[model samples]
Target: MNKVFNTRYLVHLVLAGLFSFLVFNLTYAVRPSDYDLKEGDTTSASGSDDPDVYIINEHGYKRLFLNPVIFNFYGHLGGFAKVKAISPSTRDAFITSGLFRNCEANDEKVYGLESTGEDTSILHWINTTGAQAVIDDPNFFKKVFCINNNEFNWYLKGSDYNSVNQIPVYSRDTTSTSTVRVGIIEFVPQNVVYGDVHYAYLKKTSGCWLSSGGEIGNYYWVSGSNQSIHSSDCYDILETYSFLDIFNNLSKGISKNVQRTIYGEEDTMETLHSVYYIKDFYEKEALKYGVSDLAIDIDVKGPYMLASDPPLGGRWGVGEGVCNASLTEFFVNEAISRGVDESQYDVIAYVYLGDWQLSGRSYEGFTSCATGSKSFMTVTTWRLPQEDEGVVTLAHELGHSFGASDYYTSPCPQNPTLWSCVKDPEGIPEPNKIPKYPQTKGCLMAQIIAYNKPGSDEAGDATSISNLNQAVICDATAREFGWR
Candidate 1:
């Protein structure tokens, strides 16, 4: 009896110890100290000051949360949005110089290299000295091992340097646009692949005529230093990210704004092409695909203006940068020519600045830059035409008119990552915060700008309209426009 009792007591004690250990682990796991939400399983996280919100990637469903109020803070992962400050009204101008090279005269100033590093002083010094500074040296942006999001995080940019650091100095002016201060800072992301470059800009909180996120405008450099630049770069990067974050924020925003338009909000999209134009394309393309004929509610037009006349002098993609008040009329003309009625269609055009220029069309496809007033999508005629690639390119840009995003995997000079959507074990949709649909493997839009092998014909061939490609491009576009 004594031995049995002792054994029983020992077993009870062991069980209790095991229970205690389990409870401790559960508490540690449930209590997310860094994340603010303590209620039911947190789908997303957001902080007023921190720009980088933590996304809960449970199984695959993704969610995002944001600070109730908007304000600026140093090192915010998402953005430095000023509270209650009116976001400057966005513009509807078709094209701007910085983004599209198709229309503007070649300008060297428009070209810039953004370095993702921790040291702004080093970056600034290198830019200033040009050949004199050795900023590209790998030793400069060293790494330290750390843990983030339950994984080991390797930082390429070194720890905060002892070099001079600046503080919150706001030169935000509400007066002349030129006097307003705009600054930039750079931070190495928690995860750094070889060549993934991200950029952003936002308006500061102030009672001004114009600021960031308003009509397309240039940001003037305020007093900048390593610390100041660091803050600015972080601010801009997060702001850009915030702009993108909105895509996933809404239940329907992602599906709606998949194409480009002049001034349509995410919810209420403006017309693309005239009813007639849309119907014509739909009738033609639909029959080819054996898809049901859908009535056209929107108008569409394209592939009309060549950015360059002869595709020479590195001016192959310059014609797209010429939007002003005149562009509205130009869009009207282009649409009308394509059997679009101006009354029913929203005319869109592309533009660039007179200074932006490029030599080879090697790196990427055309871009849609915006005038502070509008957005423009331009084509690079000089670069080797990707033949069938152009059709995908056109569809891709047009897709933007409907608010679709680039699902393409961005490339690096050395190593590039392919674009992939989050999926389940059975290849089903994983409910991610961002709706990542499976994209084409080697699609024209998927690959960052690679020209079609040199001598392909201009008009797209049957292979160009393959079932797989059509499903990814055309069908997706149709869905965005509500045509499907």
Candidate 2:
């Protein structure tokens, strides 16, 4: 009886072991297909030839996993799948696929996970902290998932994707109107962009006319004439006079030191004029207006010859006087070549040795004619004038550059009828009026030529007389220039 019982017990033990083995095989077979995947085999979870380790749900719309997950999961196994490591470029492609839907109806969220070779055990914590955390915190989503256009293939927040190559795929707002949309992703064109080119040229003329009595008055033939209009030849008179002589004569009587009280404080300022001598009239005038400060400083340049033949008009033609435009171009070019910074000088004064003409009349001088606020060039014919007329002319022209207009009443050569109707036609109320006129009578802008009649105060050797009183800027003129 003991031997039979022992044999029975051994058979029962064998049967029990077989039954346990069958049950284990059945359980393994019935398990999910994804769980049965081997290290070397690919899983249908990601639809790639990489072992799947984690399942990612796209807001209940689609489920997928990254390719690198397989290599990262079974890295310790000798037969683990051989896959490339995840890169920024690959990660961008996954984000741009548009397979992931918005996690919330009104909220757009994106999340990304990077693998650590040490162990995927931390992946289990993803349920409580990974994608859900990104969805909860918009800042975290932007920091980790969103990237600039230059860094990724898609446009994220603040990414400039408005070019033709990159087209926007997302709406700017949660509205039905497509008017506001995000930029798209495209390659930047390899081409250069250019801006508009600006070119300017001065007007050309054979000759210019100078009016004796301002813009509108008695006309005298200065240039392109054989006979002299004044007692002394205009050319000879201009050649004999010197700017230093004129400066010394004009500066006489006027105090170099000035005192003023501003903001309850007495301030004294000394004005100094540093004069520089040049060889020719053009250089002198150029340096005067170019280097000489409006309030101080004076310098001389060269007696350089004309760059090219002067653009003069035909003999006895309407354009027989000096072309102010041509002279301006010539002087400007010379200053540029001499290494003189044109920008340094706020004003340009052209002192011609001979009389020039403008607007069909002969004149001693003119200022701010051709170019208005731009480098206000004062063209003065250095001919001998009666009394302190030369000095007055110089002061008057310079005044025009300093926002003073001619106060004289003269009809516009082009529109005589209209100008004649107005009370000081030459004095336009505008700030930078071309051929500005004076608002007051007997002011410098009104009459630069001094008179020495019996009743005139501007008498004597003319050189000794100071025209400061006549040429001083008026209150209206000062107001126009914003000098209250």
lDDT of all predictions: 0.24, 0.27
Residues 196-298 of candidate 1: C-alpha lDDT, one tens digit per residue: 1123232342443224343322232211112232354233432122211221122211111122122542222111121122223333333222222222232
Error of 1 at 290 (Å): 10
TM-score to native of every candidate shown? 0.22, 0.29
Per-residue lDDT of candidate 2, residues 1-484 (tens digit): 0000011212212322221100011101121223332322222223334333322122111122333443343343332353323322121112111112223232243323222323221111112233334322222322222222222222132322111111112111111210101111011111211111111111211232232222221112122222322223222222222322333333331112222232332222121111111011112121111111112233334333333332332112323322456545655665567665544433444433223432222322223332332222222223222123344454455445445555544453434542222224233222233433222223345443222211123233012222332233333544333322
User: How far is 298's C-alpha from truth in model 1 (Å)?
Assistant: 10
**For model 1, what is the alpha-carbon lDDT of residue 434?**
37
